[model samples]
Target: MSKRAVILAAGVGQRLQLAADAPAPKCLLRFDGRTLLERHLRLLRAVGVEDVVIVVGYEHQQIADELDRLDWTPRPTLILNPQYRQGSVVSVAAAESALCAGGDVLLMDADVLYDVRMLAALVADDSADRLLLDAGFEAGDEPVKLCLRDGRPVELRKKVADGLRYDHVGESVGFFRFTQASATRLAQIVRQYAQTQRGGEPHEEAVRDLLLESPERFACADVTGLPWLEIDFPVDVIRAREVVLPQLHPLL
Candidate 1:
């Protein structure tokens, strides 16, 4: 399988600023003496990902400058999403070419901080397309919710109307793996969606549309008990520092 990664880092991270008075992009926020983007790149390299594409918009230069300072073996390619102010899906759309060029692609949200083992497990899986699921899910409107049936995700929505209906539901870890064919399909779908749909829709909506076309094409990788944190609010950063970071240290 081809090891490639595309990280969406274009968001303005308004919530984090409102909560923590963050002055820079959320991915640039420092924790445990390292930036979130830096840690993600390191983890990807450690897992044998040879090529990477990072979509940048909000404070793009800062991110670029940070990259310039880092001595990466195979430097990442940075793509600017002009419509970043609109939504995250635009960022994914911007990297369509790079994603389709690779054999298998790893999609990630730059705000996420996770243990390398979680990603390692997903890489080890034989599935052509997979989405990481946290079984120890926290119910909320912010996180994308997954409804699983027979160990596979049947539905994915940010806000499920009747949350109690599904016997097995999990929280999406904002990480995914797509086979080469699936990656090409995703790029086509994203392009079509961008032309027809308005902005502000999460990128997951596009993936959901792809799944609707062929539900059996995608599978879920249960990554429960793995240490990971998505830094959306100030409180999350605190938890990442106090909880997630400690758990990931041993694995690192």
Candidate 2:
């Protein structure tokens, strides 16, 4: 079956400032002569996933203008979320139509700059519900974590309680694939979060809800030693250009 992808790019990326207090759109960060958004599009096409949707706000027109500059065939669809300042849940909720389209769907964050190998690994997985994990992530509350018990996903959150029992834990790559049925359910949960104006809850909360209730439905793919960075802070931008970019494709 064909798969679709929804990229959540609506947030202001407030933490990733370029100059003193200047919050730029994270997806527009350029590396190797291509914007992160452009790289994502090319990589998805490489893996045979062409049907794409992006949620944009916080200078969304810049995104639209960027899309205009690219001559990519079968241009991506854009979903605007004016409430991007509220929380990520609203952005996910805004893509409800695309999510509930009854096809296998992949959801991912726009801020990550990673090896194309990571994207390839995700697309090739056969699991009905999928999440990417990397054991090498730096220790901090900033990265969302995936906690597994006996090879099944038991918990996922930014802050895993100190004593939670799990065989192992890894940092989430912020990329996920869900079966048609699973996608529908996830959309509903986020929609509820959006409708109720739970403005502080990140989209991860809805994902954690589905995960805890049905651990049996999910499986994880490990991408240890992979070169990837979520472009959250200024330091990451420097590292991506200086460190991660060279590692994404070492032989090139």
Q: Highest TM-score: which candidate?
A: 2
TM-score of 1: 0.93
Q: Tens digit of lDDT per residue, candidate 1, span 1-252? A: 677899999998888765344357788878778888889888887788869899999879989888888777688999999888987777888998887896888889999888998778668765668888888977777778888766656787887765445667889889888888888998998887677764567889888887767767777777889989899888998998988888885424
Clash pairs, candidate 2, are: none
- Report the lDDT tens digits of candidate 2 across residue range 111-134: 998887887788776666888999
Error of 2 at 99 (Å): 0.3
Scored against the true structure, residue 109 in model 2 reaches a CA lDDT of 95
Q: Report the error of model 2 at residue 147, Å.
A: 0.6
Task: Give the count of colliding residue pairs in each prediction.
Answer: 0, 0
